[model samples]
Target: MINSNDYKIGRIMVGASDDDVRYVHEADNLPYYHIGSVNGISMVTIDVIGHEITHALVKKTAGLIYQYESGALNESIADIMGTMLERYMLPNNWNWTLGEDAVTIRDMRTPEIYSQPSRFEGPGWESPGNCPFPFLGNDYCWVHTNSGVMNKWFHLVSTGGTFNGQNVNAIGPHAAQQIVYWALANYLQSQSTYSDARWSTMAAARDIYGECSNEHRAVIAAWNAVNVISPVCPGSGGRIAAEQIENSAESIMKVYPNPATDFVTIQLFDPITTVDLQLYDMTGKVIKAWNTKESTITFATKGLVPGIYTLKAQTPKGIYTHKVIINQ
Candidate 1:
């Protein structure tokens, strides 16, 4: 059995180059890898523990597999969990990249690494870079490779990382990871891929977090920012978390422009770790979500039709709820 101490959070093996992510013998084991040599980077191996562990958690909790959209989502869950876990251990600024934080592997937040799309560019999966498997029959053999899109998206969405000109006061990674953990462990169905996985995740986010919690918005925005197949959110949606809920046991969640016209901003109490923000309509439906793993989050309402909306956020310990409105 592989000693737990032998493995790291983002990367499993030090010399094992077969794959970046390895299932180190431990309670938390899954796909994905980390490559680096810095103390900060080496510490990321421990972060790998959470990423792989999330895989097991989802496998047992959601009964997801390593194939199709479900496979992609499974990979995404691992990546999200892995990065969040690593971030949890180390401070920001010093920790970045999924592969070679210690040795310069890949950036977790920036999807377009070195001017390359995180996902493979064509239907033909055969690549020239480090991705080992050849995309067969349009088969997504690039599960781990393509997952970079969601990985960077997760990092961005979780922490209010910017894409174009959006500002997000995201919740934090701790909450976001826990939410995904619950989602993979409980809500998600099988045969889920990128789109399907996201849809299930939205529903799960709604259930655990709320209808239009920042977590929900974070999910929608995260997918939107990535330009994935538009996640089918119900037309009529509602609110999940409140920036400042009154007369309730809800946690302290905050976002600006409750009824936003141009942009919606998000904020938290402490130094944020990771959080996903989601938006919704009136009829208990999903609109879009964002993953803000940083300290804040911002989303644009320019395209929105203009109506009542809600934002949802997923934190490390539990779910946070908030409300927002778009004036367009």
Candidate 2:
């Protein structure tokens, strides 16, 4: 659960003429949930209410843009929370299908039943390339459909499962929810991708249960099951490597003091004439920029908030990115 005072639902309008129920922010800038009717039948159910309300929570917290991967993530979070709420309220009648009371829309246990992709870019996956505009595209780049990937991941984390050749040990619903909520509130940024979510949730589990704990391992396994490989955590006997390019082995970039409290050093194995360097926060905001010919640069992390940041370098060969964490 999160701070309710900051994101209180403004109103719940029942019997609206809208085709479907949804959460929206109008001119007042307050969140409102509208329950629509179909042929004089109200579509107000416990899961429906929970789903819409979660949209409000997500908007206030992560503020994920309602398009592409971020939009899919938003939809997935709503579904996951809605299902969890339904289970908590009606344990006897709990089911994985969304809108079971009104209509069977999405199934978290098996999303392919409704033409949703359970695996990333797998069967039933919607391509964003074809849908350029949200208004014209396939449900805003198939947000509802693509959400199945993350939904399945949540299901696996809550209840142990083996998928994509990876086996995960269940962390249970309560622990899974805590890790997810913590990641959304503390680490996730507006433009976060699936890879970012993987990193954020792993970091959250580490913060809550310690590095390489069972819960943290469960998070990693669940992500790997969904085919989203996260950057290796620090002190796990491996360093976070940059994206590889053609002949990238010739120019190796090394970043030290990954979990840094005061400073970090960047050293390039192969010296180049000039390099353009930029540091960015998780929100995709550039924190620092430098254009220098030096191969080794020491950057100060003093006064910076402790969190995940990215260091990017543009050399003659290719662009490289390194993930860094600042510790207070």
Candidate 3:
């Protein structure tokens, strides 16, 4: 039994009478992973195990909703982490193929081989319009299928590649994993889309490697290779600002007592009747939330760990963000 403060995995059942392996979160709030056997062969490989465990990590952190683009991102994260784990365990024999020891479902280096698209809207891409119901069609808006785009992006980022007229310089697997993991943990949200992912990963690379660095450039090129273009150009130092609306003269939102130990307050310049507020940790996990009509709101932060956090407000105009710091 593996246990942690965040979550616990109660069981790992192998040789189940099932066609596919899966990770399940039961009503008791515990996680369980099952490995199935086919033709007397078990699908209990390291990559497969890593894939399922990464699902639990996603739930604990980003909690990305399993539908549409977010769903595809969920699957892609699992695949990326799985491949990284495989490489870590078997450094001498590691390859980009997932489940090579078992079913051989996905090949990150060559996603097209498994009928998955390498670039957005490229051949073999599955459109969400084809599936009216989430349950009836190809893996919930092609979550598994569209994940190939990101898988390909990761592959290119890890080991230099040229695709879709874009060439990405290899950053190697360690740096690539750090940037992607940082983005997943610190920037992404539950309802975040692929565009959001592009921005977040770029921001993560900037945070880690500085602006205009080779690693940052590689991240941009990789995303472009997968056709998930970011509105912000390289070396410009602007990121997804087109999606946000702000006044030139004054800020729309204000957060006070930034490096506070006890409490923090938020005030809006032009208050709407209803605004949604969310506080996220450095790990992108929601800490506190509010839906209120008041322009100024204050909340306690007594028990939170001292770190930098993100405060986001959703208003009628647009979404606004504020950086907060806590010190104990």
Candidate 4:
């Protein structure tokens, strides 16, 4: 069934039957799948075939460009989905590594085995030295190398791990795959970065597992473990005790003097580690910002017009928002 609108099925070809290799290429607005001879040793390995199939899916979904972080993300997604399929089909026989039977192409379990950084603390993405495939016009951009960050993230999310002083509960591969594919198809863009990946995956997990669910929390922890922070995820930066602040009823935050002429006092019912306070006007523009480790902090509203404003407090206990009116 060949349909122009159907990306699942496409033109497939087999070449170099006497050589050991496989690849996928698109030419003239059409994709072609090629398989090479592997000396009849593990020629039918589902893992390798699945890897190529995932590339097709990536091109169809995110259409990720093959450069920089986006390219690395592209390679990571292909490996992720490919390995996931291999594991699902043969749970006991499969392992957290690519190239199941052919000399261990890459190890997803411990990327360091191949000198890939499992965390994002390594070299910067723009480091010219990290660029791979110099002969191919530097199009690789350490795609396979830096992919370890996300590969480790997937492993942690699927199997559970303790990272960055936080414990993540394993939701199994089923949940991980769902959240990952959702992010790839919906949240990720052509130029999305690692931070964007974190946000998208968290959003995907949120949609599947609810904002306050354990799965959603695991998604955040897994990325944080890899030192990948989400710029858009809630309670991201104001982490207390190295964990995101979960909303709790015990630690109640109070704001005094709702109709204040000059200042407002933010008081916490319980002594917490830290708090990020933000004051915004009716237009949602931030009027003031403060980071305090004290139990209470006062925000001055002097030299301001009389109007309604919002005061937001971010703490390890959760996020609290209140309405304040300033009258002169």
Query: What C-alpha lDDT values do all the predictions have?
Result: 0.55, 0.78, 0.79, 0.70
lDDT of 2 at 119: 84
lDDT tens readout by residue for model 2, 87-168: 8999889888888887777998899999998888788988777787875246777889889999998989989889989888
Clashes of each: 102, 0, 0, 0
Candidates ranked, most accurate by lDDT first: 3, 2, 4, 1
Once superposed on the true structure, which residue ranges of model 3 sit more than 4 Å away at CA? Answer: 4-7, 38-40, 231-328
- Candidates 3 and 4 compared by lDDT, better number: 3
Best-fitting candidate, scored by lDDT: 3
Per-residue lDDT, model 2, residue 290, is: 87
| Predicted candidate 1 versus true structure: per-residue lDDT over 165-232, tens digit per residue | 43334757765665565455434667655665555556555545665667776776666666553333
lDDT of 1: 0.55
Greater lDDT among 2 and 4 belongs to 2
Per-residue accuracy of model 4 over 105-215 as CA lDDT, tens digit each: 677778888777788865433443465454344546776677888988999988997876766779888889888886786557788778878877876675455664678
Residue 37 Cα positional deviation in candidate 4, in Å, after optimal superposition: 6.6
